[model samples]
Target chain A: MEKILLKNLGRPGFHTIDSCLVNGGYNGLTEAFKHAPESIIQMVKDSGLRGRGGAGFPTGLKWSFIPKDPTIQKYLCCNADEGEPGTFKDRGIMENDPHLLIEGMIIASYAIGASVSYIYIRGEFVFGTRRLEAAIKEAYEKGFLGKNILGSGFSHDMYIHRGFGAYICGEETALLESIEGYRGQPRKKPPFPALSGLYGKPTVINNVETLACVPAIIEKGPKWFSSIGPEKSPGPKIFCVSGHVKKPGLYELPLGTTMRDLIFDHCGGMLNEGRGLKAVIPGGVSAPMLNAHELDTPLDFDSLAAKGSMLGSGAVVVMDESTCMVKTALIINRFFSHESCGKCTPCRDGTPWLTNILKRIEYGNGRPGDVELLESLCTNIFGRTFCPLGDGAVMALRGALKNFRDEFQHHIDHKRCMVS
Target chain B: MFSDKAKEEIQQVLKKYPNRRSGVMDVLRIAQRERGGHLVKEDMEEIARILGMQTVEVNASAAFYTMYNVEKPVGKYHIQVCRNISCLLLGAENLIKHMERELNIRVGETTPDKKFTLSTVECLGSCGTAPMMQINDDYYENLTAEKIDKILKDLK
Candidate 1:
């Protein structure tokens, strides 16, 4: 299908504002200026655009949540802190075609009545950070940013806020706290960012890919975008295929594409011709894995959710038969444990506890009831944490056990990895 | 204490945020870079003084994030290998072992010459280019023993 998000990528000097302008970059902001902010939000609502950052919340609905009063201060935060394992699509947009993201941010800021915005990028993305800094400068020089823009009354200023190495900051509240120079920890909900965020004012936080889609939704009519993929989760989604694939990279396709086609047709199947496919993490490591038998499942928000997994961040990780499922579970659990912000008692304590058990099982010292112990631990931590970090760890481990309980049992019984 | 030039850069960064406290991340990054790859106690105190935050608050913020190397110093080239899920599935462990053997340093140690520090990070977000490592600010991906040797040789 036609690429909306990554269209500017791979073009010569695509990162430059001149090239982006030639490719009809700021046309969205120009189009946006012609319409009232309410109409733009309504147009986005009609487009059926969902947030690409794990949670598939409607982007228009999110924008509409901002208090309409013009006097109350509001801010828009573009979450460029792409720390989810196996997810690099945001990095691609930020590094290659940064202007696309900047333009999208400007339009989004206008729609949400945000006079100021921040791109909270991860600290390790030094190159992407510099690219965005230069691109923002270019945008400012062209009057796309600062005081008035394209004769429009909306005045917006965008800045880059680099986050230190904290995965929990990917959470919206944690991101806000990090931006406010506090420990990156999730706060209690109900007074959500839409109501009171970012120094206790109304704020709208969007993922990089989510905001990047705004320009396209505004440029092309909402019907055009809504008709591309499934009626519920429509739009061209960037599936980041990595691990045990022949062609492991970014593939922008319709959202409802089958996992089988994504791996076999798009990614040239698995890397090891002899071993074949073992499992596929349809989203990042957070989402539950799909065994080889379930490759026919369509990769969308609702479809994956129906099959006990969500299309989170569109990071499809394919693992071959050579991979030890037990080890894979252990590695995933270890990541969550390491990244768990010590805010909640259950997550802070339970993740490392889960990791310790997974480690014992991977090292062939698992007792008979270790799987049951893990299941119990998962149940305890699933909804008990301050955020979904603990739930993600449990879901990943549960997915592994659901498909490869035999692998864990084999390691326990045989005292060695079943694969190796 | 930061140099005058570093202090000026910090001032510029402070202007970007609405509140002075919001610039702590960038300020800490600048302090770390100025101190040659790590933050010392005095640097945190200086940042606290500049941002109008308590020194403990600045230190807590620094310790919460993994990128800030508090209470430790790094070499000229800080090599962080990706040992996360995607990288692990593609044999990042072997490449990390290769790096250790060549550098004569463990995962979190600096070399004797203070030229290279080998460490393993969660994920550098370059999983597509599996078996990747980051040297300072740049990414070195699709790595092998020969590539690691060549990169180390050039750095040395």
Candidate 2:
């Protein structure tokens, strides 16, 4: 499949309005304006595009959830808080091709009848922020964003909002709360964001990569998109492969690519020819780690789910035998501990305890039951939390223990790390 | 107090939203930038006054978020190194220790002369470029000791 989303990947001046126009940018929005809003929504519905932000919800179905009759207000939020430990694909689109996201947002807002859109970015992404800010400015100056945009009598304004260094804000509700200038915490669902989000109006929040695919779906019909990958989850997915690889960067390919192909063929293999691969965290740290021998697992949502893992944000972090499994578990525990939003007891309390146990085991001090205790802690925290953060932590750490119990046992019995 | 220019920018930011409460984060960012990389009680109070919010509310906001630096000053260069999983796998911890030995300041400590402040941050979404550090607004990726030395020398 050709790269629809990143078609302008390495183009010089790709961020500028001139280059965007030269390369047929905003053509989707122009073509979209020619169709009735319902047709646009219907086209997306037939595309079968799932949300690329880890939760594989159908994008068109999500847009259809907004109330057809305009109510008090509506909002379109672009989740650019790319804070997942191993996920960096969103930042690539934001930095390399900001205009694509802008065009997608325009078309999406039109389809959803939204008058305003906001790009909520991570505070650590200062570089992406600069590029997006410049892109938004150029978009506005070219009448692509404000005051009857392109003479279609549809006016939409866009802004770039920044989170103040919190990973939980990646949650859509938490993102909504942060944009509302409160403590970034997740709210109870049942009134999901589609109905009441972003200032209690009808809202549609999408991941940066998810929204970046919209313009293409609009330009090329939904049938063309659904044909790229497997029937359920189809599209050009960008995999972020890093660590223990020679060519560690973004590789845009069709979905259902095998893990071995991505790591070996695309990323140039592990540490070296002699070094044996130990494990692969196929998704972000939130997802479970796949053992070295499970390289044949297809890099898609259903395939990974069938394998007791997930294709979360397409973050493929590989580690060779030289890497310590205990330390890896400890590092992930620390990340979840520091990022737990403290909204619930399971996540807020259990994450730190998990971190503590892993730290003690990694530091050459381990009790005989420490491994089982760790398992019990993960069990207590897994499904009981109010949000998925708790469940995500349990999946990652618990997955590590189940797959690398020998490594953990080595730490406990020998009272030292196995790698060193 | 925000300068007139900053006040105008804050107002413009506020104009982007319908409710003044929604503009709190951006307002705080403006005040932090205007006050030279940190926020003070008076600055929060001033922002509260401008946005029709309480001083305690503004102060709590500034304290809750990690990006805002308060109660202390950083050096001319704030070197925030990444220490997350991918980064750690690629030896970010040792690189941080190397930085400590070279700079003579531990993580979270500023140089006595205020020329450098070394700290570790969560994943900056640059895991693809592991063992990376951010100095101010720029990301210095694919790091090594020699590259660190060059970056430090260039910073001066």
Best by TM-score: 1
In the range A1-420, model 1's lDDT, one tens digit per residue, is 778778766665778998788889899999999999999999999999999999999999999999999999999999999998999999999988898899899998888899999999999999999999999999999999999887797898999999989999999999999999999999899899999999999999999998988898999989999998899999989999999999999999999999999999998988988888899999999999999889999999999999999899999999998999999999999999999999989999999999999899888798999999999999999999889999999999999999999999999888899889
| DockQ of structure 1 | 0.89
TM-score of chain B of 2: 0.95
A40-92, model 2: which lDDT tens digit per residue? 98998898888999998999999999888865578999999999998889988
For each candidate, what TM-score against the reference? 0.99, 0.98
List runs of model 1 lying over 4 Å from the truth.
none
DockQ of 2: 0.83
Candidate 1 chain A, run of 10 with poorest lDDT: A5-14
Cα deviation of B121, candidate 1, in Å: 0.8
TM-score of chain B of each: 0.96, 0.95
Error of 2 at A177 (Å): 0.6
